[model samples]
Target: MGALFDHLIAVPILLPLLAGALMVIVDDRRRPFKIAVNLVSTLTLLIVAITLLMIAGGMTASGDPARTSVYLLGNWPAPFAITLVLDRLSALMLVLTSVLAVAALIFSLARWHRAGPHFHTLFQFLLVGINGAFLTGDLFNLFVFFEVMLAASYGLVLHGSGTARVRAGLHYIAINLSASLLFLIGVALIYGVTGTLNMADLAARVGDASAENRVILEAGAAILGIAFLVKSGMWPLGFWLPTAYTAAAAPVAAIFAIMSKVGVYVVLRLSLLVFGPEAGDSAGFGAHWILVGGMVTIGFGMIGVLASQGLSRIAGYSVLVSSGTLLAVIGYGTAPVISGALYYLVSSTLTISAFFLLIELVERARDAGADVLAVTMEAFGEDEAEDAEEEVGVTIPFTLAVLGASFAGIALLLAGLPPLSGFLAKFAMIHGMFNPTGLGDGLPIGAGTWVLVALLIVSGLAALIAMTRSGISIFWASIERTVPSVRVIEVLPVLGLLGLCLAMTLQGGAVIRYMDETAASLSEPAGYIESVLTAERVARAPSGTPDPAQGADEETEVAP
Candidate 1:
């Protein structure tokens, strides 16, 4: 039973891969099979959630004061073979991924066919890649999963293949492909320096390396950082993001919200583990650069949001802003700050994805296909008198009204309003930044403090103004046309997502506590390395074989 549970680490990544393959063969004409796939995807998500709960419970029982799980593939030894590590951080990310997956799947139910053939297939594959990226412990494997996800996303981005979508998709592909190249180069360099790919082992080796090797390591790390930054839509590197995300179908864009976070996850993981405080602060390489980068990203995204006219584009830019804010929090490198960042990550994922979904509905109602200019023109025309009334005072479907209100709440929360998860998340992070604690020791406060305060004020104000403008355009501005009727199925998914956002806000405290624990676990990598390597060697030892023989072979190999 214990062995069975250990293997469960692979389930989150494997189930989606298997489901994706099966979806390709299942007759698309059969609605039953499609429903089955959705059910299975939901079940897979449940399984992941259960696995996280178990991991948390085990940590409680161990009395070891650390929460970590490691699964070696095919009973192979770590540092020599692949391993899947699930700590508080990875488990939390897994849960977040699964939550978003289930929500996106539900949202796509009615719109899947309309999205194009093999919609379910692409979606499942995307989930597979996402889960795999979160679980894998090898750097190269991470790149492989990233490519898989990117490939699936390319199809989803250009799913309908309109001119705007195709153009945006091309831009997206070109930029990401370049990032992939840089990723490969960086990984190759890191491997050359350390001769190991496992994250835990790399962290151990990086900590022990000489100053010269450390320089090489940091250089490679920077290159890898650039790749992730590009993926996360950091300023200047993320110019393609808004166009691409806006051009995607609504359900597809909802999934994309999860997609962008993968990069942020990687950066956070690497910064804390492979480049701990000792190494990072040695040459001013700690979280300072990340803080600066995050602030710039937030500023640029806010400007983009305020300036954009299209609802979808506005939502896209909002994603950038959220990503920036989360990154800034992570860059603070404090337990409280990181915890708050994790909470924000969850809140932002749900809220932003819901926002995109709502934007789609709003665009459809306005008869504007990612064209803000056209929608704005129609809003003022006398021919759209009925639509104007519907836009402002009309009776929307109950579900849609709920969803709209939910989106409004998310926007308000993101702008740092009180009584919301977003506000709480920011408060925790800021508290950690200004008033240093044990977890926050060694973090530079002089420059970082001023930057954090500036970011808070500027981002909050910008988000408030942009969100309000968008709300007026979407829900209040007069329309010279009749809006489309909201579909019943569509209403259900939107409302479900909205409910999730509200729930997160209501339970902010508990969630932040969990996030804090997760961040602390991530900061310490020794437990992970020892568990994986030790368990793997024991599991792989031949039945009835004496330990001395295995030890002799390893000793002989290392001696000369």
Candidate 2:
């Protein structure tokens, strides 16, 4: 069982790749078969992810102190071969990705899949990239995974084929191309200076770099960060995000809520592991920049949320806000804060994704002409009189009622209202910020801490106002609009996502404890470096027979 679980670590990447390849060979006319394949593969991935998460958290019988599994490709040693690492953080991301993939896949069955050719193939390939990026142990593989993800996303973004989608796709392509160029250049410079691209090896050697190489290294890191920040939807670099997200198909948009976090994840991982306090002179490098940039991003997102008329745009800006909050908390550089940020990360991602999926349903409930006229009137400052008809009792259909309740729930979550995971997440973060070391210690609160606190409060308020206004316009003011015909398939995914948020709220203690442990591991990365650098290749049996000393089923397990 342990051996089987060990091999399953690689399944998140391999299963998707195989499924996508098979899907490509199957003709597009046979989409039902392809969909079935995709669904099965995704479900398998979800199970694997949960198992790996348990293993990483030490909930399993694998009593490895490090709680890290390093899978060396082609049975080669680390720092020389490609490797995939399974640890607390990577496992967490895999679970999140798989859950979202399942929800999005189910939602797409409602018709979004027919909007494009090779939708299933692209979707599976996208998962491959995302899963690979999360698990890879080296820098070059990260780049490879990043490109695969981006290439698939380009197709997904343009899936529904409209003028808006085409326009947004082009801009999205051009900007990401530039970012990719930056990524390559940064990798090259870092490798030239450090002579290593394996993340673990780089961390081991970075602190010992000469003064001259250190400057070049920092420059490379900064350039690389710019690329990540662009993906993270940071202020200046993310102007394309709203339009592109708004144009994407509903399932695509829903999954993309995590796409932005890919940058945040990389930044967080590298910053703590590579440039940590152990990096000597380079300790805390670029952290202040990240802090300030994140705050600025939050301010920008707040404004965008307030200014956005369409719910899709509001959701897009909400992504930026979530990213900024995580970045800021990461820059604060405390284990406690990171734990809370991780909690917030999961909460906001689920809420935002649910919001994106729900938007499509809500928009369906309204008349297209009515939507256009509402925007037009608001834009031209035309004040319309309210209907003065006497109050008449109206029966809300079960569909609209469910959708409205979901919308309200999403709004409350996004706005950090009480009794929801979103509120708890924010509260946890603020609590951590105030007590950076611990509540028992006496420490002066810094100005940056106060600034971050203020921004969190203000952003929540902004989200509340925007969501309320949009809800009223869609549900209340548009009384004459028809109730959208919705299938159970579509509604289930949205409910599933929101239900997860509620689950988080109920399981807050366990979640926070897990995050705390993950954060502690991240803070002290020596264990990660050691686990990767010292990982062993599996021993081969001679003469096509297993050695008596080694169990036949356990040959693939990492050597003790």
Model number with the top lDDT? 2
Against the correct fold, how does model 2 do in TM-score? 0.94
Candidate 2 displacement at residue 243 in angstroms = 1.0
Tens-place lDDT per residue, model 2, 1-560, is 36677688899999999999999899999988998999999999999999888778875356544457988877666677688999999999999999999999999999999998999999999999999999999999999999999999999999988899999999999999999999999998899988788999888888998999999999999999999999999888888998889999999999998899899999999999999878989988899888888999999999999988789889999999999999988888888888899999999999999889998988886665665566675568543445344335667789989999999999999999999999999998899888877522223588888999999999999999999988877876675658888999999999999999999999999999899889888998999999898886677667778444334234432321
Candidate 1 lDDT for residue 530: 73
In model 2, the runs with Cα more than 4 Å from the true position are 59-66, 369-389, 439-444, 540-560
| Candidate 1, 1-560: lDDT as tens digits | 26777778888888878888888888777766876886687666767666765575354544755446777665556665578887777777777777766766776776654557777788888887888898899898999999999999888888876899899999999999999999998898888788887887777677666778777777788899899999999888888899999888888888899888999999888887777754443423547778778888898888887787777777888889888887777676777677778877887787788777777666665645434654456467446665555456556655445645866786776687777777877787777777667464546678767877788767878778877776665555524344546677766666766676678778866677677777666666556667765653444356786543343335311110
Worst 10 residues of 2 by lDDT: 551-560
Whole-model Cα lDDT of every candidate shown, in order: 0.75, 0.89
- Model 1: how far is 515 from its true place, Å? 1.4
Per-model root-mean-square deviation over C-alphas? 3.7, 4.3
TM-score of each: 0.90, 0.94
| Clash pairs detected, candidate 1 | 384-480, 384-481, 388-479
